[model samples]
Target: MTIEPYQWAVRCPETEAKLAIRGLSKTFGTGAEAVHALVPLDLMVADGDFLCVVGPSGCGKTTLLNLVAGFETPSTGTVRLDGKDISGPGAERGVVFQQGALFNWMNVLENVAFGPRACGESKALAHRKALATLDMVGLKDFALKYPYQLSGGMQQRVGIARALTNDPQVLLMDEPFAALDQQTRETLLAEIRQLWQRTGKTILWITHSIEEALFLATHIVVMSPRPGRVRAAFRSRFNESKDPLITVAPDFVEAKRQIIHLLGQDANKEEV
Candidate 1:
């Protein structure tokens, strides 16, 4: 008897799954007064997949993110990475919040080195790794600056560098650029796309901006309101488009229109 590689993967998920959420759900409080945050949902984030999640308010997008990050436990089902059940936050996954959550007291170099240091890395080695990661994010020269001294975009770069310094298998970004100006957001979006291309890291990002998702995501998932469920999912080619003005292209515009329609339907449903 001969076994094929793909067949073996079915039997050995640990070798195949980068992150997997199976029938996961979340609810806050208890009984009739409880708030149902997420309906049972299944999602598989394959190796190196850049997945962007978009949804209406109260659709549990952030809850889903937190579940996968292990900051919040699912009320039902499970989240797994490399086939191991996720119980809590671990170095295997790195999260970037909406604002640059940097320690104001720490210099840029210290902030970037913080993760490695927490993981028991020697000071010399951690600082060296931090320098390399900072350079990757184009912030090596800002090492001596404090968080308040840097621009909003620069601080976000430090946040990204800090996450990368840990060498996590996956990145969980929750609207990391939501607070930035439009021009800065676009610039950071392009940089993030390039970084993904260079690193091949699996990412699960939550965002309200459809354009941002269209520009950066290889795959996009749209969720319904309240107890959120997947309303639609798309594998997009716009990210592959070389045009800088891809957002205005016919195909991109059409795709964006369809997503807006879905969101509109959810909004209508919520009102009723």
Candidate 2:
């Protein structure tokens, strides 16, 4: 008798997982001065799903990411990954912050290899693996440059490569492209969409840009003001092959419009 490959499904070599957040609530301060950051929010991310979270500035989008990343504790409820409770940061989840986060002293190669090296990989093997990731993000030629010497976009590319090299099942990005120019942001968006297609990693992205959310996400999660809770969720699963430039496309435009609406008609009023 012949045995089958470990992953019967090509899409997932690992066992399918379901991340659950039950009766989650969080508050800051107390009594009259109390601020409710999140209020009984419940969300689930199945294996390989790409979810984008959008909300008003004080809506607790990052707060939610922090809870999931295990950087902070929820005042109530629980965050469980594959039925296990999350008490602290885990290698199962990798994160990329909003700003460019590359080491100024270390060159691009060293910065990208930091995680794997700290995980006990040999120096030669870590750098070797780092090189492969840098190549993936089109930064192979700039591997020797220090963080200060590279442009803002290049620095961000290195940060992303570092996160991707860890092979985390879930990738959490908090406004990762908010710092880049329009053109650079567009380029990186395409790069990320490609990476998602290739790596099949579950991604939870937080962003202020409606187009960006619709472009790279299979699901869009919108939140309301303080005590952030889900206001709306949209499905763009079959919209994968759609180009970002196709924003003018009817479906794309409609989705974009609806997301803007989900943000609340009053937000535009405040921006004005």
The candidate that achieves the highest TM-score relative to the unseen native structure: 1
Residues 192-231, model 1: lDDT tens digits: 9999999999999999999998898877889899888888
Task: Give each model's whole-structure lDDT.
Answer: 0.89, 0.81
lDDT value, candidate 1, whole model: 0.89
Q: How close is candidate 1 to the true structure, as a TM-score?
A: 0.94
Task: State every prediction's TM-score relative to the real structure.
Answer: 0.94, 0.89
Q: How much is 42 displaced in model 1, in angstroms?
A: 0.4
lDDT of 2 by residue, 1-272 (tens): 11111221243222344567778888888999999999997676777788888887999999999999999999999988887898999778889999877778899999989998989999999999999999999999998999999888888888889998878888999999998999999888888988988988889999988888877877777888777888776666433665545657776777777777767664765578
Looking at model 2, residue 85 earns an lDDT score of 91
Relative to the unseen true structure, what is the C-alpha lDDT of residue 46 in candidate 2, on a scale of 0 to 100?
A: 74
